[model samples]
Target: MGLQPIGRRVAAACAVVISGTAMTLLLPGAAAADHTDPPCGPAADACINLSENLSWLMSDGDVTFGPVPVSHGKPGYETPPGVFQMSFKNRDHHSSIYDAPMPYSVFFNGDIAFHEGSVDQQSHGCVRLPHDAARTYFYDLEPGDVVEVVP
Candidate 1:
């Protein structure tokens, strides 16, 4: 079969080495030929998959980190899905509304942020990540960076 066309981002991320009639594709964290594009487009620096409860950090469409577990809003307080710009960041933020400590907080949408929290528990509307992941996101993502939430 002939190869199909791929976008620049996908091609760049998937390193293909063709030798004779054999082709080898090298992708980190991939066990098979799963070369699907990241949840958000190339512009997104962070992408959250709500259904899968996973998140990723990207740079120019290449995944820099993750597929890490995350906890998002539950039921009535569902995490909104859309592309948003990272509003700001706070290393140690306390929630005035919930009276909770949010460390390494990276705010994207209004009142919604990615923070170090319990991944097993449901959040009000924020995306809860582990301490390490939260810290990485806070340090790596800057204001105006794209954060995309997908259902």
Candidate 2:
């Protein structure tokens, strides 16, 4: 009777250890899967959360990179909110209208793009990101991929 109780206690301990080990092994994969599933849904390759002033790179529903800081158009030139497809990319694009250097430009709307610029300053109806973030987004987004700008 005493031996039976001891055996049951041993079994319970073993079960706990096994369960813990299984959880430990499964956690990393679960985390990876979570990251791969895009926070913006499958249709969008990138999502710009305007109110947050942040952007993300997504694939297969996963967020591959970023919540990078961005600056959009100022009061008069407010960046339009809607879904737009990437129209083109230019590594050294210059804005003819503004006659300004717009490096690593990824155009998603008529004259607006995701480009390298001062995050602290507003853009001319464009989305401006820091150099590195703009470059990464420029390369990651392809023409025809969706860019959703949400409030």
Best-matching candidate per lDDT = 1
Candidate 1 versus truth, CA RMSD in Å, comes to 8.8
Q: Candidate 1: misplaced stretches above 4 Å?
A: 1-37
Per residue, candidate 1 scores C-alpha lDDT tens digits across 1-151 of: 2223233223124457899999987553232334345688888889998998888878888786666679999999999999999999999999999999999999999999999999999999999997766766777788899999999
In candidate 2, what are the lDDT values of residues 116-138, reduced to their tens digit?
A: 99989988889998876676676
Assess the local accuracy of residue 125 in candidate 1 as a C-alpha lDDT between 0 and 100: 97
Q: Which residue runs does candidate 2 get wrong by more than 4 Å? A: 1-39
Clash number for candidate 2: 5
Each candidate's TM vs. the true structure?
A: 0.76, 0.73
Evaluate residue 130 in candidate 2 and report its C-alpha lDDT on the 0 to 100 scale: 80
lDDT assessment of candidate 1: 0.80
